[model samples]
Target: MTITFRRMTPDDASAVTAFLTANRFPFHVNPAPCESSANKRVAEGHFWSKESQGYWVQHGGKDIGLAVLEDLEDDNPVFDLRLAESHRGRGLGVDVVRALCRLAFTELPQIVRFEGQTREDNIAMRKTFLRAGFVKEAHYRQAWPTADGTRLASVAYAILRSDWENNTVTPLEFDDLLLDA
Candidate 1:
């Protein structure tokens, strides 16, 4: 169950293109993506930029997923993760997320927190966030738009660097809306 992360490079274009095209990420607004589009996006460095970097989620010496970590300059960095279709539903999300947390907390020393978001309908991902020690920070209604123009609520989660290092969960205070009599 060895899991590792590899920084993606231009040489990985074909492999990334194939991996993204072959899988259907139903939880995303655009579940089915065309191969050519995927290739073009990868070639265009959609995932790799000055503010962001993409990585290959390798398990047991094989690439099984992709993770794009963004918002590098901010105190809070976020990530987008997608596992291969065959690798989904096998309890790998938590492991991958934990690895992401390690990369964020260690590689980016200035970051105070690491964040991730998923559609409200994506219960699996939400659970994975919880399992990986991310606290539910927000739920924005009608925030995530779909391919057909419909919208779903977007749920946000985060893990503090302190919490990650200490192996603790520091719950957010959500009672700010209480009205005084």
Candidate 2:
């Protein structure tokens, strides 16, 4: 809980590198050198590369996980996320996802929607997405190769700006607008 979002810089690489290394699964860390370089390039602008832009998950000032949002103009921008093993399964993941959604909707007006996809076997992440109000949209069977040489299915979840409309959260309308046409 109590997460914060901050811009990424070259200064964050060491902290981010250490945060990413604790991953128990190999899926989190992408091994291309260009990935880091590309993020550095994006740091000059408001946008950041999915690899290096470093939107982190911190608990008690320690970097327990890492997340990155990229392709800001896409109908559904891509975000990569990973949490350290010790921090998993404590409901913080959903909390983090909700916080990220608030940021995306508030900061990026062009982002009509936000979406994420994960291997179907990654149930924890899938649950987190659902808890954050992202509805399951599609499942692609045998679309990805797993670490065990078996194919995996990918599932997409999304929530639109229209979906954020709160029927009860806002004060109820009591005027001509509330009357039938």
Candidate 3:
């Protein structure tokens, strides 16, 4: 299935709202979001603001998800992806991530890395990150807040431009404790 990305606009508010209302993202901060608020957010440019940009993940001429690109001005941009329920479990996350990498690395030359984070329990997203050539970088304890007023460990992943271009996984050095020798 051919997957593509289109920059989100105000005109896409209805579709965005529908996508959000249709899916129950367990890992998201607000899982059961209302369509009206989703529309308000879209209209207010919450995702597609000066510091960030959003996109519609299209598959077979239909919008299957939304990818919100954050911290665009930074050297490393992060993305929050939410796929529709009907499109989930069909192995589409990896393709969306790969497309994101291409957009970040090729379109934005200044970006050296593209980052993403998911709850520790989100196995599907973790696997998708690895499949898309992203390396595990960090894990923050109780960093992700959920809809039920609880927190979960957030696992960070990133794909360097060099890694994306070269198609390799360059491991990050995390063992930096120089203890008493």
**C-alpha lDDT values of all predictions:** 0.91, 0.67, 0.87
| Best prediction by lDDT | 1
Q: Give the Å error, residue 40, model 2.
A: 11
Model 1 spans > 4 angstroms off: none
The residue pairs found clashing in candidate 3 are none
What's every prediction's RMSD, in angstroms? 1.3, 8.5, 1.5
Q: Which lDDT value does model 1 have at 71? A: 86
Per-model TM against the reference? 0.95, 0.74, 0.93
Q: Tens-digit lDDT track for model 2 on 1-181? A: 4876776666776555455443464443242224454445445542344322457677778767767776765757767677777887777888788877887788778777777788887888888877788777778898767756777788887777667544112222334356568
Writing each residue's lDDT as its tens digit, candidate 3 over 1-181 gives: 7788898877777877887887888888888789887878778786677778888888999888888989888998898898888889998888889988887787789999999999999999999999999999999999999887889999999998888989999998899777897
Write down the lDDT that model 1 would get: 0.91
- Which predicted model would earn the best TM-score? 1
* Candidate 1 lDDT, 1-181, residue by residue in tens: 9779999988888888888888999888778879888988887786788778999999989888999999887989899899999888998999999999999899999999999999998999999999999999999999999988899999999999999999999999987789889
Winner on lDDT (1 vs 2) = 1
Pitting candidate 1 against candidate 2, the one with the higher TM-score is 1
lDDT of 2 at 60: 70
Ranking by lDDT: 1, 3, 2
